[model samples]
Target: MHSQYKSRQGHTTLGNTKTTVAAPSWISDFKEITKMRLSISVVFSSLVGYLLGVDVIDFKILGLLALGGYFMVGASNGFNQIIEKDLDALMERTKNRPVPSGRMSVNTAFIISSIFTVLGIIILYSINKQTAMFGAISIFLYTCAYTPLKTKTPLAVFVGAIPGAIPFMLGWVAATDDFGIEPGTLFALQFFWQFPHFWAIGWFLYEDYKKAGFFMLPTGKQDKGTAVQTIMYTIWTILISIIPVFGFTGTLQLSIVAAILVFAVGIWMLYYAIRLFKLMSVKAARQLMIVSVSYITLVQIIYVVDKFIR
Candidate 1:
């Protein structure tokens, strides 16, 4: 506290007061509730897929897809937080989230989630019936199936992967309003990539996740078996990534050089996965997580550039 008093010669004096300014609590609360960075990154994947699928890109549709994607992902995360408020408070990583930290009421979070879900579907439906259908399904599966199962089974990763992988192919669906081998290949790429990506995260955050009773790893531990499956999925990711170079993905075809570049990054990621398996350390797991993120982005970039050039 501070007080001001009149000084001699009618001068005003102030004592022991300073001000600290921060973003409004509501602003920070919104960002945390939506997991804004993650939602944007998810939208980026969808945009990449849209670019690959479109012959002539429509900027309007692209914008709508981004908005809709963000809303849907945000809604899912919000609902997850609402359901796991207590669980999130139990884990170091998630304890500061809005619902868990008491920065926002659960009812408020639920309303935000429900609104986003509806608006996301309506925006997506403006694009195409198929796109909206997928968005709705993604929201339903993620909140209904994935969130509740997180603490119940190690297979939650498998369940979570379905909605996680949808964003990429959802863009293709947004572009063409069709479902076929093209979007399927894109879906497969993301689907396999998540196993290694998330398993590495699971390994590194094992203790924290255990505090919340989250069985993220396939075998529910950071062991050789989980590492081995990480390897298997990483291999599958690489195979699916390179398949376009063989001229089998229809409109999703890639140049041999792009495929080679993709393969190089995949092997780079695999090297880290092997290190995680051998070292069995959080350090190695963290490195694998970083590489897996880079691998997906690099490969997606390679595919998009290859598509435009060819």
Candidate 2:
């Protein structure tokens, strides 16, 4: 009888241990739902904008801007997941997301998203009304327009780029509290950069995206047309990035050296893009995607560094 009791106790202990080990913490779930890494990248772009616009860097405002940007982007991502929960389950890449995987309830996710949205806007408002307005607009467009349009048409990439490009410009708004040629130039640079960056993603993830009825490429297929379009947009992105060096971007002028470096980075991106066009292979597309990310990151870094040095 004692032996039987001991065995039952052991079984109960093991069961409890397994249950405890399997349950994820609230923080982990929050991070997953918010797409933390993506949110951080968005915040980084906003920070770059703020740095470029401000002659005097206020760490307090900078911190608030980063926090605000993160919350807004987090809210957008959370709402997107909630809206696309069913579609997410169909795609292997998104199947394990918190909402679709049954780890988070829709009602709970919605509430969290709402809280973040309010918090984000309030924080941005602390910076300035224009900054807050742009943040709110970004959230609205991303959640309402971009999220829903994904499954309906490939034009979703174009719609999505609007909100994506806003972050960089939003920072300038936060700093200057005005939308002018400087912020507009920043917006144009990021606006055109999205094409090659996202099309490469679309090309490589064609199978996964198709599983969920998302067509992100312009031609709706991994064809030479899409590759050619990617090349064209890359050229546009390169051209726009160097416009500041020509003394046409108001107060946001890049030095000749900075422009040269930026052009070289653009060439690097274009080289990979051309390779993708020639090879028309998934591997080449993946390479372009990587180079595209590096290109933008390097360009932003060079711009900021040039501002300080010259």
Report, for every candidate in turn, its global Cα lDDT versus the true structure.
0.90, 0.91
Q: Candidate 2 on 86-162: residue-level lDDT in tens?
A: 99999888887778978679999999999999999999999999999999999999999999998888899999999
How many clashes (backbone atoms < 3 Å, residues ≥3 apart in a chain or on different chains) does model 1 have?
A: 0
Each prediction's RMSD to truth = 6.2, 5.8
Judging by TM-score against the true structure, name the best candidate.
Answer: 2
lDDT of 1 by residue, 9-101 (tens): 233346865322123455667888999989998999999989998989999999999999999999999999999999999999988787887
**Consecutive 10-residue window with the lowest summed lDDT within model 2:** 1-10
Clashing pairs in 1: none
TM-score of each: 0.93, 0.93
